[model samples]
Target: MRPLPHHRTLRPDRRPELTLSQPLETLAFTPWPGIGNDIWETVAFPNEGYSYEVWTSVTRDPEATGGLRGGVTVRQGEAIIARLTCDPDTPSQSLDVIYDLKESIGQCWDFTSRSWQTSCG
Candidate 1:
């Protein structure tokens, strides 16, 4: 696997964000190579305070086999955060995700420059 770029700083123009802590909860993940598609789910902690995001992963690989690994995090609503792709030769996938929501700047920013997402990441 290649080394992906790390986003240490938050986006100024994106949107307001929540101070979600690390180690989010894992909900569910299903991957199928035999079916020619991999299913992935995780709650998204959007920049807009807090919200939910559920998405799917498509492998589009004919020789792929096994299941994808991912998780769901829940705070108030639900969302998917992390996901794993199937290995090229091997057949396995894992991920870090969540399922939930907590909206509003009060819920998001902690009403301070020092926020959960700010100091943690």
Candidate 2:
């Protein structure tokens, strides 16, 4: 995995209204393993009343680039305000630390079926 950048930038076409230029060190990063060989990475930024979470899932296959299949979710308290899928060639950061946050919260990706499952079977 690549090192996290000092700052993260979003594609202009992805969400013109939403811009991320702050240093990533201030954000929270979480990494967790999926059902089989897949892994989920999430970076969250908290705002005044809401938070923005960027998530991506990748397989153990070294050739697979998972950035093409993730999205950004905006949430306020426990409610999801919006969800925007990422476009091709979007930029995402990978951090060195792993928090296993998703799995602890009961979220996992089923590698065989290539879908998300509440629990790994």
Candidate 3:
């Protein structure tokens, strides 16, 4: 995979004050190639105050029998607030279009902690 861009800046005019109660549009979506019979996808939502990412995995591998496996990560500014795993029976969002905005601030996903954090670390 290519390295994620390190340089990004938020536009002054696009700064929005948002809350969980308000309707939000998808900000980014990333899909990973299937391994064996397992497929994975991740979707991001960016808000002014807090942002969130949901990752889902679907497996048809008979060796590892399972339903859907996924979780949600919530962030406030540069700090991670929560990481929650969904039940295997739960459903995830389905998206058709994929686009990324380079004008917005960027963060890194820390696999060790399973959360998003500032890239400097």
Candidate 4:
């Protein structure tokens, strides 16, 4: 996990717009070590006036003696706005990352809060 980037001023004064680089694609959780039992899910565009992709992936490392970790990334358009990377050694621990988006922003999962939190540039 990484420290979430600080917030940027919102353009609430500007009307929210739907300007996609491409037709929004269906988001899926694809694991890296694609083996053993794993769990994952994705949610896209959960809010009005914003397009967001949120997903999580969970897996157990056999070599780590049942250690579990999950990685998730939240993206808008093709750019990643936030990421959740589990600590390799402490697989159970996760960190959330937030990025800077120039004109748009949305919400992403915060493992610490175990809930969705606002994110912005």
* RMSD to true structure for each model, in Å: 15.7, 11.6, 14.4, 15.5
Candidate 2 has an lDDT of 0.61
lDDT of 1: 0.35
Q: 4 in model 1: Cα distance from truth in Å? A: 26
Best by lDDT: 2
Which candidate, 2 or 3, has the higher TM-score?
Answer: 2
What is candidate 1's lDDT per residue for 13-108, written digit by digit as tens?
Answer: 887544543332222222222343554434344444444433345455667653343323333334333333333333233332221222211123
Q: Please report the TM-score between candidate 3 and the true structure.
A: 0.47
lDDT of 3 by residue, 51-70 (tens): 78778777667677677787
Q: What is the clash count for each candidate, in the order shown?
A: 23, 0, 0, 1
TM for candidate 2 is: 0.49
Candidate 2 Cα errors over 4 Å, as ranges: 1-15, 21-25, 33-37, 61-68, 88-121
Clashes by residue pair, model 3: none
lDDT ranking from best to worst?
2, 3, 4, 1
TM-score of 1: 0.23
Where is model 3 more than 4 Å wrong at Cα?
Answer: 1-26, 34-38, 92-121
- Provide the lowest-lDDT 10-residue window in model 4: 94-103
Model 4 per-residue lDDT tens digits across residues 16-38: 54433332222221222334565
